[model samples]
Target: MVYIAEENRYSDMPYRRCGNSGLKLPAISLGLWQNFGANKPLQDSRDMLLRAFDLGITHFDLANNYGPPAGSAEETFGSVYRSDLSPYRDELLISTKAGYYMFPGPYGEWGSRKYLLSSLDRSLNRMGLDYVDIFYHHRPDPDTPLEETMGALDQAVRSGKALYAGLSNYGPEDTLRAYDILKSLGTPMVIHQPSYSMINRWIENGLHDVLREQGVGSIAFCPLGRGQLTGKYIDKIEAESKSGNSSMKPEAIEPARIAAFRKLEDIAKRRGQSLAQLALAWTLREGGVTSALIGASRVSQIEENVKCLEQGPLSEEELREIDSVSAVIKDIPW
Candidate 1:
């Protein structure tokens, strides 16, 4: 059967502005970082993508190194886009990044102009896209000069390879520098992608403050702490979970952490939500975050996550208990 999106898709999901840019992403965005890759089941990938759209998730995030074989996820997305999502091109916020290791040799990785631009071309080719809505430098390359990398991103927007430019995994100072460079070039930086969850509060220290001050929107990945904050690990890991698949090592969820997870689960139940819902709702409570990026191998997971928005934001007392539980959990060392 051909895929026709839900007519009321736009009604249920809330959209927020990405920084000061005109682009607005859904409050819940889908990410293809794990099981949606080529090595994974293609049918599952297609189902999840279609389901995400039905639930009003317009933003789909990707990276050059996302798939197990590297670049496979884009290829999968390309196939699905050609077959189903072509009609809704203008309505989607498709984004891909070019940092991290992609191919072999010197030019395959980093923030250099050569690597960033060329990787983007490959990403576009693989996705069968004329232009991506957003192109991001996957990570900060310490060896490369900030000017060179930011220049490449600006050039991408100017040349129309990407409608907007973004930065990922960049610290507050580096983000400010990149933003200034993009602003000088007449293409201001729009968004930042960082790893954030109740279990990992790295952004609370300074990243959030910087993003708000600089007016850059934030999309937080690992919103469930790589499945730690979800019900998947509340008891024992399912045989098919990410932890079972090596994306998250078994040792990452220790016995004590599981205990903490159950305690949090009770709080989520009290709030009329699942553990995953509680985690996502808490992540969005941060003022700087524009969206919380969620990755799933199954359509059911996406459906369950989408239902979180219906329950509304966490209450003040609930927020305090969540913080206490998160604090009691040990730092994930795996």
Candidate 2:
């Protein structure tokens, strides 16, 4: 069948500006961090990508080391893009990052200029893109001078290999420093990707305030807490087969946390939403990230998650109740 997108795909989903930049990403973006690798069927990856676009998810986030084999997710996305999304290139906001362990040896990872630029080239090559919309330093390199790393990102935008610069997994202090460096280099830092969810509120401590002050937009990953907040664990706790490599560990699913998840599920029911939807809605509430990045194993999961926007933002009372329930839940020591 031909893959013509739905005409009304842009009708319902809202697009939020990325920091103070001219770019605006769909409030709900799809992430290729998992399930889009060579290990998964290419057809499944294609289906989810097309369906997410059909639902107005214009932004697809990726990284150089996303796949199990490393670089396979970008290949999968490249295949799908060439086959179905080629014509809509101008309408998409594709972003990829570096800074994690990718290949072996000295230049394989970290925020060094050599690794960052080289990794960006590989990412662009794997995705079959001439340039990415946003290029991010996946994490702060403790050894690499901040100037050298930020310089590479600035150079990426200057050379037309990336339209904007971004940072991920950087703490509040480092983010401010990176922002200053990018700004001085004449390229405005646009967005920051951080891990945030109802269960993990680390960003609330200071990251949000820094982002607001610096005018950088934020997109939160793991807003579902690695699927723990999906409510499926309420009835039964299954061990995460992937363990450290991928999914959350079974130990994180303690009995008390499951009970708390049940309380959240009850709240979701009262709000006329599924647990996943409630988690996403809460992640995107006022003063939250600019977009909530979601991963989907099935097309139906994407559909269900996108509907999180339809029920609207969580109310003050709902927020309080959610906070109370999740307050006791601690972040897994990964």
Candidate 3:
């Protein structure tokens, strides 16, 4: 069956500028991490992509090690792209990253120029892409020289393999250093992907201020605290709950965490937003954040989360209340 995107999709959502760059991403982008892996049904993944595009999600994020078996998510995305999204290629913002355990051997992972470029080439092949909109050095490498990694990013842009370069999961000090190197190379780092949510707020420590001042945009992933803020486990984990394989397992949701969650739920109700919606809205409140990178296995989850657009930059009172719950929710077990 042929999939046709909605012509009015552009009006379904809003776009915000990514840093000072010319690129603008949807307020909520889709991430191909867990549910899009080979372990899941291809048709379900395809349907999610189509519905996301129809709802104006222009950016789709991927990483080389996203699947149970690394690289399978990209392979799945490639299959769907060839069958459906190829026609709307010009309207999409596709990004893929390296610097994680992608394959075997020493060269399989890390920030070395050899690994980053080769991994990107393989990524392009897997996705059948001429070039990704932005290519990223997925994380900071302690052993690899920052210059070598940044140079590979610059080389990628100079070679026309990627339009812009980015960094993910990097801390404030490292981001500053990398930005200086990339700027000197004349290929500025435009964005950062960070783990952020109501419960997990490390970016608030300093990264948010740095990104805002440096004109680098941030896309926050896992804004729901892996279902803690979703009201899913507020009462009890459901029979069909994904808690078994979830990063936030049942045992990790201790009584202390639930007490804090209950408070947040009450606050969200007063704000006229669900716990999940409030979590998403809170991440977007900061001017430095470009988008909320959300993952969903089903279409209904996407539909429900998109309503975050209708929510808010929570009030000062609500914000204070949320801060009170922060301590109880941090350092969740992996």
Candidate 4:
């Protein structure tokens, strides 16, 4: 059957500009970090992509090392693109990153121009794309000169392999420095992807201030704290079921954290939201990131998560209660 996207897809969802650039992304974006890998069923991944598009999620984020064996997630995304999404390509915001360990040897990983550019070409080939909407440095490289790394990003944009450049997991100092370097190269940095959630409030300390000063938009990943903020482990930590979630180690799931999550659940109930929705809402509240990047195992999870947009902003009282709970279990490394 031919896949015709929902005509009214743009009716309900809101879009925010990426930093000062004209690129506007959906308030909620889909991330292919986990379930889109080769280990998952192709049909299942296709269903989630189609469902998310139907719900007005325009952005799909990926990275070189996302899949179990590395680079397989882009292959999975490419398969779906060639089949169902090719016709609607103009409406999609596709992004992919490189950094971290990809292949062996010196040029395999990190921020070197050789690795970043080569990895990007491989990524484009895997995704079957001429150019990505945004290409990001997955992480900073301490050994590589900042100019060389940022120059690689500028080169990617100049070579027309990526429309805009972005940074992920960079600190405030590095972000500003990279922004300046990209600016000097005539490619202004547009967005930053960071791990932000009720549990991980590290961005609030200084990164937010830097981004605001530079007019760089932000997309927050792990807004659910890798399923902790979802209220699934409020009663008991199921080690077998949650082992895949990186933040759910036995040592991290202390009883005090469980109590804090239960308290958050209570707040969610009062606000007429599920624990997941409340957590996402909190991540997008005042002074929060421009977009919340979410991962899903099922189409229903995407359906439920987008409802966070329908809910009102967190009230002053709700914010205070959330703050008090967050103060206890701050920065759980999600």
Candidate 5:
């Protein structure tokens, strides 16, 4: 089947400057962290990718360990890339990461120069791309020297395997170290992917200041707090609800979390928007966030999230009220 993109798609989203970089990214970017794996139907995944493109989401984030059977998500994305999005390659900003378990033994994961370089080659081969727009370390490896990790990232860009380098799940101190190493290597880090939300305030502890100082952009993953901040579980976890499954882990649905979700739901009611919309808008309240990396299990969820950008930024009073409520119940097993 032939697919044509919407002409006015770009007008729907407001792009934010990525720190001091020359690039502008959509306020909300789609991530294949969940539901885009081989476990799901191929057509459904393809439709989601095409629909996101039509809505002006040009950046798609993936990782080697995203799928249920590791690497399946990239393979699925590769299929769609070749069959549908290949013609629009220049218009997309594709990114993938390594530094997680994929194969067995020492060479399978982490920040070793051999592992990173080999993983990039495997990722590129799977995606059928000569080079990705951005490559990232999935997470920090305390066992590996920071210099060695940064060196591999530097080489990835130098060898033309990736255009830009980024770090994910690294704290402020580690991020600063990475920035300095990448700077000395003459390939300054461009982006940092971290878990942030109305409930998850770890970044606020210090990471934001460091990123701002270093001019490194940030894209927050799980901005909705893994569907908790969405207020979907206000009453109870429905038997058929996706959140009830083992994949979500029952421990994540603690009593404290439920109470906090209910309070957020009340705020959403006052704002005249769904709890999910409120949660997404809250993430964009802080200006430095270049994008909210979201995962959706259904097309309806994506459609709901897209409406958030239309509501614009939150008011100061609204933010204050949110802060007040957050202070009362901040720690929610995110």
Candidate 6:
């Protein structure tokens, strides 16, 4: 069946500026970090992407090493793009990242001019696009010179291969350095992607303050704490849960995580909203966050998550109770 995008897709979700850049992204963006890989059925992944668009999610995040086989997710997205989404390209904010291990050898992964430039070319080929709206360095590369990395990203924008450049998983000091480097090169940093949820508060140490001061937009990933913040794993793991099976590694389901889930579940009960909704809304409550980058294994999950937008921000009392409970369990060793 040919997929037709929803006519009123742009009406429901509000868009926000990406830092001081001209681009505006939807409040909620879809991430293809999991389930969109080759291990999953193609039709199921396609449905999720289509459903996200119907709900007004304009941004789709991807990385070079996202697939189980490394690069298969972009291949799958390429197929989807050729078949269904080609006509709506103007309505989408497609992004891809490099810096993880995609190929083997010295320049396979990192922030070198050689690695970044070659990776962007391969990514554009895999996605069958002339250019991506945003290109990101998947992580900070301590081994590579920051100048070389910033130079490569600046070149990507200048050469018309990427419209904007961003950094992920970079701390305050490194981000400031990169921002200055890019700014000096006449291509200022636009966005930063970081892992943030009620359980993972590493960014709170100083990154959020830095982003606000520097005028960089932040998009938080894993806002549900890899499904733990959703309260789905409170009493016992469901037999059919994606991350709950016995085959799943123990490290993925730590004892402290279960304890945190129990505490979050209690807070949700008092608030009259699901733990998932609370987690999503709480991230947005912080001022610097431009959007929440979320992954949904099914169309139903996407439907449930979009409901958080309607529920809006938590009250001051609710925020206080959440913070108190969250602080006790925040140090859960992940």
lDDT on C-alpha atoms for all candidate structures: 0.88, 0.90, 0.87, 0.90, 0.85, 0.85
lDDT of candidate 6 over 185-209, digit per residue (tens): 9998999999998878889888888
Question: Candidate 1's residue-wise lDDT over 83-107, tens digit each?
Answer: 9999999999999999899989999
| Cand. 2 Cα-lDDT | 0.90
Clashing pairs in 2: 19-217
Worst 10 residues of 1 by lDDT: 235-244
User: TM-score for model 3?
Assistant: 0.93
TM-score of 6: 0.92
Worst 10 residues of 4 by lDDT: 233-242
Enumerate residue pairs that collide in model 5: none
lDDT of 5 by residue, 227-257 (tens): 6676545544433234545343464455555
Better of 1 and 5 by lDDT: 1
Query: Mind giving the per-residue lDDT tens digits that candidate 3 earns over 42-99?
Result: 9999999999999999999999888757899999999999999999999999999999
RMSD of each: 3.4, 3.5, 3.3, 3.1, 3.2, 3.4
lDDT for model 1: 0.88
Which candidate do you rate higher for TM-score, 1 or 5? 1
TM-score on alpha carbons, each prediction: 0.93, 0.94, 0.93, 0.94, 0.92, 0.92
Give candidate 6's error at residue 68 in angstroms. 1.3
TM-score of 2: 0.94
Give me the displacement of residue 122 in model 5, in angstroms: 0.6
> What lDDT tens digits, residue by residue, belong to model 4 across residues 240-318?
3355664556556666766677788899999889999999999888788899999999999999999998988999999
Cand. 5 Cα-lDDT: 0.85
